[model samples]
Structure formats: structure tokens, C-alpha cells
Target chain A: MYVRAHTWWTILRIALEERLVYRGDFALGTLMRFLPIITQIFLWWAIFESIGSGSVETAEIANFTFPDMVAYYLLTMVGRAFSSMPGLASGVARQIRDGEIKKFLIQPVDMVGFLMLNRIAHKLAYYSVAILPFALVFYLCRGYFTAGWPDPLTLAAFVSSLILGFLLGFFLETSIGLIGFWFLEVSSLLFVYMLFSFFLSGHMFPLDLLPEPWNLLVDLLPLKYMAYFPAAVFLGKVSQDELMLQLGIQVAWIVFFIFLSRYLWKRGVSRYSGFGG
Target chain B: MSEQQPVLVRVFLTFARNSLVREMTFRTNFFIQCVSAISWTLMNLGFYLIIFHHLNRKPLADGSGWQQNEFFVFLATTWIVFSIVQAFFMPNVQEFSELIRTGNLDFVFLKPIDTQFLISFAKVDWSALANFVMGILLLTVGVWRLTTQSNNPLSLNLANVLLYWFYVACGVTILYSLMISLAATSIWLGRNQSLYDFWFYITNFSRYPMEIYARSWGWSLWGLFTFVIPILIVINVPARILARPLRPEGPWLGLPLSGFAILATLVCLVISRRVFSLALQSYRSASS
Candidate 1:
């Protein structure tokens, strides 16, 4: 067990090193990503201005004042940063299609465990470089956090939700990629997944803003845990009573996806033929 | 050189035909792409629908003169412009760095035809035209709604329609100019992976009505995009002509908004052409 843990640690260190080598461009790219927030500020400001008759401070649209809306968007960006697995699904699909899965099958290395560690390393490296830009943007928009920082207990809930969101995103995407075992190409499927994820995960807008039946339907899904839920928690939108309930639901979804991915991997490997090599 | 114009047209036609053939070879992929594009449009439409629903079907929150139907027309115009860029120029510009890195650009220079023209029209993703069709449908619906509404001042005459299309062309030209100029930087940067991200960010400002940016704190962004980048006019001028024609009294410096759009398009084109040539001169080929 000790040797195995040491091996995984070595894998993580190498992955982290590989990511840090590209840290220069990573910082610039991450800063560039924040440019859209300027547009968002202008847009929401206009919306609130019209609604409040030039008094944007008091305007509330869908329970969000102007500052709350801005803060929500900023917090959602943080949540998305945790959950976005840019090319993980497609990359895994490619490996399966190219028969690279044989490497894991032949070796004693567990594919899911190995990939999860690599992803953790990737997150560590990404956040290390990205933290500066995040801090800068957050500082510039600090006025929007009108309620200021959450209480310590709420902060703990927010932090835990983000970590669970990360795991849920990873497992959910891996399960989709595991479909490559049956279907040689999953690009089209991945495209569909991306489209749904972008909308359903509340990256585009808060799910609470969704109307009637749609909001209710979206509430039943686990996608909110990835983005909307954490942002809502930070903004004190979620009630104290519901916070524990929501976090519990997130854990349940993560467990469900973890099992689903492991099941697919086992089934896929059992039927797998080591062709060409 | 005067006769070369006809040959260039022929070459463009050939490139378009070859691209269609290539697209047809992947029938399922093309179908899926069309579905994906349509799905995205629907989702965006749904988002706006919810927003309008919240406002009780009022004009955009800032009173930007964008009622639901009028905004739909603007949205349609955006989709039309975007589809043209996506179908014709986006794929080519995205692959510009790849061509540079792989040394294929050297062969592009060896050709007798205009290098910029050749590179820009090399491939057409026909599936992206699905958005074009969707845009036309939405445009028809929006126009129909506008004409039928009582007390609406919308004028759906032939002159307005013609002017709308002409400005739509100008909008497409401005966007194409911006894209090509950004792609040209790959010659210096070696690999401009952020080209798409930057393009997405810049063009995002053009997606909404220009009035949104005219307010406090937004004035600087409004100035930057309108005068310096000129992207703000791309969709705004065209959509305004069709959706809500600006009153003649509001002309900027004796020129109508559409007139300014035409001038901006010309300036953008000239600037991008100069930048492309300048970048090409600095290109160190793969062998070097």
C-alpha cells in the first residue's frame, strides 16, 4: 500500500511539473478569459438600470440586485473553473478509440485512479498560476460582494461544495467518455454533452432565473451542484437548512457517477479485444 | 491583372465545391453538426424568452428600444452574420497557425493567385449554414410579427429591406477583417492558440444592442469597441435598419449609422489587408 501510494505521488509530481512548464501562457489565457466579465457588467448594469429607473442599486431582477447579480456571475466563474474539464471527455474517447486503453489493461495501474490524480495535479497547477488573475479580477469587483465574505460555517459549506463539484464533474465526464468503448467515435456525443452542460450547469445564467416548470425540472438534476449551487451558497441564496441537504445531494451524485464510470470501465474491459498488438 | 478577377472567381467557386464534397463524405458528422448548431440556437432563444418573460414582455431593461420581436430581429441578424463567418472564414483562420507551423504556408506563397484570397476561401463548412437557415426563419417571423402589431412604427418597405441586406454584407466584411487580422498574427506568434478565445471575447460586445454600453462606466467600453475596433456597428447597424430604423435627426457627424457602417467596413478591410501583407513579409518559412 505504501509503495502504491508513493507511485501515485510520483505520477502527480510529474503531471504538476508538465503543467507548470506552460504556466506563462496559462496566466495570459486565464486573464483573457475574464474580458467577457466587462461585457457582462455593462449588460447587467443596463438591465438593472432600466428596471430600477436609473437607480441600479435597488433594482432586483429574479431576487438578484445589481451587485448581487455581478457577484453571482463572479462566483459562478469560480465554480466553473473548478468543474470545467475542458477536453477530458474527448481525450479519453480518443485514447479508447486509439486502443491506448491497453496500457492500463496490461499494467497494474488503475486507469480511473491514475486519471483522477493527474486531474488533481492539473487543478493544482492551474490554480497556482490562475490564482493571481482570479485575485485581481475579484479585487477589482470587490464592491459587488455587498454581503461581504460568508460566515465561517457557510464558507466551509461553499468550499466543500466546490470540491465535490470538481469530483462530480470528473466522474460524470469520465462516464461519458467510457461510452467510447462501445462507440468508436464520441465527438458528436461529446458535443451534445458540452451543449447540455453549458446550459444545464447554469454557467450561462443562474438556474433560479429559469421560469416555472423549467426551473423545477432543472432543480431535480445534479448539474446545479457544479455551478449554480456553490454560487448560490456564497451569495446566501441557499437557506441554512437547505445547505446541508444540497451538499448531501452533491455527494450522492458524485457517488452515483463514480460507480457508473467504474461499472462501464469493467464491462468495457471484459469485452475488449487487444487488436493489432 | 484585369482578367485575373474572373479567374479568381472561378477558383473561389472551385474551393467551395471541393469543400462541399469533403463535407458530404462525412454525412453523419455533418448531420450531427447541424443538430448541434440548431440546438445551441434554440437554447439561446429560450434564455432570452425567459428574460423577456421576467420583464413581462417589456422592452430590454435599459429601454434600448428593443422589444421582444425587434430584439429577435437583432438576434437573427447576429446569427446570420455569425453563420457567414463560421461557414467561410472561421475554419480557415483557425487553421492559419497550423499551416504556418507545418510549413504549408510556403506553398501558398508559390501560387500565382492572391495569397490572402487563397487562404481565406480554402474551406467551407456547409453544416454551419444550418444557422443561416435558422436565422432566415427567425427573421421572417420577427418581421411578420412587427408588421402585424398595432401602432408599431416599423416600416417594412423594399428600401429598408435592401438597405438591411447591404449593411448585413458590411457587417460580415467587418467581422472577416477582424478575424483575418487576428489570424495573421500567427506568423509572428508561431502558434496563436488564444486567437479564438480573443475573437470570442471581442465579438461578444457586438452581440447586444449598442445602447447598452452608452451608460455610465460603460462609456469607455462603448468608445473602445465603436471607434477603435468598430465591431459594435457590425450587428447593430444592420439589425437597426431592419428592426427599428434610426430617426434621421440622430445621424453622427452628418452620416447615418448605415453610412458609418459602410465607411467602417472599408477602413477595416484596408487595414486588415495591410496587416496581412506586413505579416507575410516577416514570415520565416519552415526551412529558415
Candidate 2:
């Protein structure tokens, strides 16, 4: 137990140091992240205003009018802050591929602690600098910040769901990156993974807007937890019961991917040629 | 004249041929990448379709009198121009900044040709050839669906279309210039990757329909285009070629487009040569 606690402390220290080294990058990335959310919000607002006459009211797809879309996509921004884990996946892969992780293996550090700390550090910096301001501006503009907060139990469930959501996301991406060991190139594989994420993860637009079976089919995947369901929770759309159900599902998927990643990493390292020479 | 042009042609063709041969060893990988590129276009097309269906008979984002299909076609054409740049011009210059950092640039300088041309044309991604072909096919479909807005396909007539190709060629040159200039970072302080990231994300500015706006904002982007980032010219010039007024009160827009394309190309070539020489001077060779 003492050894594990020491490992965790070491990882946290390194992660904190990493953030300091790339302070400018984090700041710039945070600013850029706002652009997409703002662009999507304004563009969607214009689209709905023009098409809906004032707002879409067909009772189709959750009665999402022009204004509701603004609110919905804002939720998208906040959830994205919580669930997006691109750095952890790519960072770990590069470390392994470059054999930089050898330094850690020779030390007394825990692998999970290091990975989680790296993720936590980036998110802490990014969320504080960028996403929080974005969430505030969006809330003040739309009046959803206070009005949209569900009851305490519901809000608590929402936050709990997001933790599981992030875990599943990290697992999914890291497992794919782990393939870099056996495969000569994981760049193309990562691109393919991004393609799926863009569509299925509700990154661009929600899956519900698509055809019938697709909306239903997407729920079977953990992607809905990544962007869509979390957004729904933030909007006060889901009930406590549904939130609990989805949270359970997210946890199950996370465990499955974690196990899969461990298996792949072990099998892969056995084949690693230490191509450094 | 024939001797000069033939040598250039032989160089480009040989580069293309050898890259194709090298890529064939991993043909399955190449095929998936091509399909991946195609799928990207399809996803964008899908989003536009969803919007188009929602916006039937509606005015545009700015309360302008533009039809959805008109803006859609404009966006589609811009995307096609984007694909051409990504496929034809980007690979060489895109690799440049990273190459400089790793000292892999020595191999490029050792090549027996104009270092500018060779470095700007190296690393021909064979998969991108299919991407180019696929883009034109998507553009054709986009134009055909554009039948909703125009009973006459006269806008796509061959003579006018050839002029548009000239504009696209101009756009490619400017893209190379901008990329190579950014790549010249190896000369100053070796700051390529971060610079490339800035360039990569800036391409988002062009992904939208230009007809919806006058591209006056983008014209100022020209300052950034010629000097800071070349992708601005690559995206905007092509749109300028195809940007039709919603009402068509103007006599001709295509002429100005041809002129701009030529101007941008000349600027690209000149700037590129200067940048290359500076990079060469800065080179502390591997032996050093």
C-alpha cells in the first residue's frame, strides 16, 4: 500500500511538471477549443432561426428548436471538457514506442497512476482556462447555467456518469494506441478511430438526428456516454433512473476495455524489437 | 523550351512513379486510407444534406437571399479545392518542418535538382491520387444536385471549367509557398511542429461556403495567406473563381480569379526559392 501511494505521488509530480513545461501550448489549445463550440453554437442558431421560422416545433427529436440547439451544443462543450482524453492515449503510445517508458519501468512508479495523473493535469489546466469561461459565457448568454441544473440527485448522478465516461474514453483510445507495438504504424489506425469517434461519439451532431435504427444502434456502443448522454444529463433531460442505468453501462465498458488494453500491451511488449538501434 | 519543360515533367513523373511503387508494398493500407479520405467527404456531405433538408426554401445564415443548394454547391466546390491541395501539394511541405527537426532534411538537400521543387514535391502519397479522383467525382455529384438551383448546367461548361482549373493551379502554388515558408523555421530556430499545428487548424476557416459571405474577411486573410500561411490563398482563390453573386448582377467574376491565381503562383515560386536558400545556409550538416 505504501509503495502504491509513493508511485501515485511520483506520477502526480511528473504530470504537474509536464504542464509547466508546456504552459503556452495548454493556453493556446484552450483558446482554440472555444472557437469550435462558439462556431457550432452560432451556426446552429442561424440555421434553426431560418428554418424553424422561430424554432423547430415538430415534436421531432426532443422538440429541438433553434434556441434548444444552442443550449444542447453548449452542453456538448462542457461534457467534451470532461470526457475528451486524446492526450493520455497519444502520450502513452509515444512513450512506449520511443521506449521512453523504460525510464519509468526501471523506477518504482505505478503505470496507472502515471496515466491518470497526466490526464488529470491536462484537464485541470484546460478546464480552468478554457472550458469554464466558455461554460460561463454560454450560461450567461442563454440563462441555462442556473435554470438547467437538475435536482441534486440528478446532478450528482450526471457528474458520476462523466467520470465513467472519461474512463471508457481513455480505455478505448489507449487500447487502440497500444496496437502500435505489433503494428508498424498506428497513425492510420488512429485516423480510422477518429473517423468513428466523430460520427458515433456525437462529436459533430447528435445521433438522434440521424435515421431511426442508427440512433438505437449507437446506444449499444459506449460513444453515447462520451458526448451525447452526458450532454443530455447536463440539459436535465435524463431522469435519475436512466442516469444510473447508463452509468452502470459506462463502467462495464470501461472495465472491458481496460482488460483488453492490458492483454494487448503484454502481448505486444513481448514482440517489441526495441527498434531504437 | 522543350528541354526545360521536359526535364521538369520527367522529374515530377518519376517522383510520382517511385512513390506509387513504394506505396504498392502496403497496398491494403493505401486502399483503406483512400476509403478513409472518401468517407471524410461523405460525412461532411451528410451533415450538409441534413441541414439542406431542414432549410428547404429558407434564406441563409446571415438572412441573405441565398438558397441552401447554392451555398451547398459553393461549399462542395471549396471542399474539392481543399482536397486538391491536401492530395497534390501538402505532403512535401507538411513533412518539411518535422524533417528539419530530425535532420532528415540532409537527404533532401543532397538530391540533384532545385531544392525548392524537390522538397516541395517529395513524399507523394499514392493514396491521395485516389482522393483527388474521388473529390472530382463528389464535385460532379454536387454539381449535378445543384440542378435544383439551376436548370442550366452552363456554369459547369468545359471552357469556363478550364479557367477554374487555372485558378486551382494558382492555389496549389500559393499553398506550397506558405508551407515552405513556415517550414523555413528550420533556418531560424527549428520551430516547425508548433508552426504546423497553427497552419493545420487555420484550414478550418475555408471549410465553409464562401458565397454566404463576400470573402472580404478572407481577402485580409490574403496578407496572412501570402506571408504567414499559404492555405488561405489555396482556399480563397478557388472560391473567388466559383463565387457567383446570388443575383448575378455582375458581368464576370472569373477573370479576376485567373489574375489572382497567376499572381499568387508567381509570389509562391519567388518566396519559395528565397526560403530554400536561407534554409540551406543555416544548415550545419551532419558532419558538422
Q: For candidate 1, what is the TM-score?
A: 0.97
Tell me each candidate's RMSD, in Å, in order.
Answer: 1.7, 5.2
Candidate 2, overall lDDT? 0.65
* Worst lDDT 10-window in candidate 1 chain A: A46-55
Which lDDT values do the candidates have, in the order given? 0.88, 0.65
For this target, which candidate reaches the highest DockQ against the unseen true structure?
A: 1
Cα lDDT tens digits, model 1, B123-218, are 898999999999999999998988887865566789889988998899999999999999999999988888899899899999988877887778
True contacts kept of 1: 0.65
Model 2 residue B6 lDDT?
Answer: 78
lDDT for each residue of candidate 2 in A1-277, tens digit (9 for 90 to 100): 9878876777667766666676666666655655555445445655665665545343223346555566666666667778887656666678777887666556766455567677877676666567556755675656534355578877777787777777787778788777777764577778877777778887788656766667688888887888887777766667767777777888889899999988877787677656452
For this target, which candidate reaches the highest lDDT against the unseen true structure? 1
lDDT of 1 at B89: 96
What class would a CAPRI assessor give candidate 1's docking? medium
Clash count (model 2, backbone only): 0
Q: What ranges in model 2 sit over 4 Å off? A: A37-42, A52-77, A87-114, A121-158, A174-191, A239-245, A255-277, B1-3, B57-76, B102-112, B147-156, B211-287
